[model samples]
Target: MNWKGHITLGIIMGLPFISAPEQIFLLVAGALYPDLDHDVKSEIVQRGLYISGGLILVSILAYLFRPEYFNVGFFIAAILSSLIYVIPYYAEHRGITHTFFSLGVMSIILGYLTFKLSIISPIMASLIALIMVTNNNLLGKSIAISVFAWVLYSMISTSFTTFQGLKFYIIPIAIGYLSHIVGDCITPMGCKALYPSNYTFRKKEGFFGVAIWALLVFYVVKLV
Candidate 1:
């Protein structure tokens, strides 16, 4: 499935957790996260490089002039941006990144990073950066605005400092990540969710797949 389809499916998967705008944005970001492994020929790889370079430049400028704004967090974010570009540059399309293993690992890393760097959620920044680099279209803008609003709310609210740790994010991240895998499973190129086994899993063909997804969405919506 494409980004739009994956994003829609991801939202449905995360419906039960969607009480706030941040969760919605996170869901969207998670859906698109798997495609980070696109080949070098892909526009995503090129954009990743640009985003990485931009972050590095910003980090340097902040260090020189805005020292307070620059810290280990900025350095860590820069390193992450570089990895985001480098890893996808060498990764195979729909390879390890598309697997459930990658989903869990990424979620854990992001969860930890966000908590460890509380002054600035690298998880949100990195994912928002990915959103920007991924599309640069209407969807990206929508997600950005949502994230901006969430940040504004956080700053205005008392919960800013008392932010809960990894546990707060693990569920939504996993839901969104797994939703991406499920979205790909409906495609002709089925997803190998359980990697290292070389087994591909897909939904039934034709209307059956659509029906299953629709039914699931309906059930989830009802519960929500």
Candidate 2:
């Protein structure tokens, strides 16, 4: 899937947890984080440095100024989340970043954040996870434009209200991350989600992809 499709899948997967719509950005971050290990020439690495840099600076300021309330764990974990997911310079495209080990580490970090902090810190942390430069599934500015449109549409049209905020946030972070791997599974280049094993299988993209999208649309309708 392209970034637009991955992000749309992330939103639909995370739709159940969304209430105030700020969470959608966080979900988008999680959805795209799995592709964090890109070559130095990718768009995210070149253009997204500001995002990750700003996040690091913001996290530091929050930690220094609001030590009583700031979630230092989340900040640290967020940086670590990005660092841990990247493959070494010699690895393949969907290398360690797409592995189950990476997912488990991320889940643990996000899970700990959920246990310790308010939802806002986790949102920042999600953005940090998206700091890497990857080469696959990128779209043009159209991707960002489409993401904005979809979120706006959901916010305007959906009736699902807020619930347990922390639980909702954490659950969807996991789902968004997994949803990326699932989306990549259908591609000709399948993901190494299981890790330590060359045992991933590719799904036929034609009918399989259509069915997944159809199910997502149906689920979105149900959410409405």
Candidate 3:
């Protein structure tokens, strides 16, 4: 399925856990982000960059107007912008990043950035970044990811242990990302969700999309 279908499924699977605007944004963004390696031309990726840019603008506004959240605003923008750009560049379609290990690593990195970095903004930024991975038209994704990979080499290596004070808000990112990988199982070349397992769910590829959409509608009703 495309980003539209994937994003819908992701949001549906995620709505039960969301009550805040930040989570909502991140959840939808996460749904569209995993496809950065598959289809860089997808509209969701561009939309995500717009969203990220908007957040950065918001951060700047906060820096000038809402002094209380200024540091956090910029921090959130910076962290998210970095992550969104990095994932797609290093990862190929259905490559290592599509695996459970990569997902776990991404989640851990997100958790550390959220807590160890000071609580709220890092997670939000990570969510934003994930969405923006699709934004290859601008190539900001490439440059940003390269710089981030080099700069955060040491920190990323030690990130798994940094989740000291994480909360429930981050669950959406994990769930949405998982939803993306699973949804892609409806393709001829199945995703590398388990990496070394070398599995493909071609049998379910044709009609599974309908099932996902059904679930999405069901979840949307409940959320409403």
What RMSD does model 2 have?
A: 6.6
> Please, what's the RMSD in Å of model 1?
7.5
Name the regions of candidate 3 deviating beyond 4 angstroms.
39-87, 114-165, 203-224
Whose lDDT is greatest here? Answer: 1
lDDT tens digits, residue span 136-164, model 2: 34433424643575567675676454445
lDDT of 3 by residue, 100-215 (tens): 67666665555444444445465455443443444543334433433343344434333211112454435656666767777777666777576777765454642564465456
Rank list by TM-score? 1, 2, 3
The whole-model C-alpha lDDT of candidate 3 against the native structure comes to: 0.55
lDDT (0-100) at residue 49 of candidate 2?
A: 49
Q: Please report the candidate that would top TM-score against the real structure.
A: 1
* Candidate 3 residue pairs in clash (backbone atoms < 3 Å): 80-125, 84-129
Tens-digit lDDT track for model 1 on 1-224? Answer: 87667776776666554444556666666677778776533576677678778888888999899998888766776666566557556768887877878788766655444445444764565455335335557456646555654565555343211114454555456667778887787789887777887888777532444465467456544331
lDDT of each: 0.63, 0.58, 0.55
Any residue pairs clashing in model 2, and if so which?
A: 38-133, 38-134
> In model 1, which runs have C-alpha deviations exceeding 4 angstroms?
39-41, 50-73, 112-133, 141-163, 204-224
Q: Which ten residues in a row are the worst by lDDT in model 2?
A: 126-135
In terms of lDDT, which candidate is stronger, 1 or 2?
A: 1
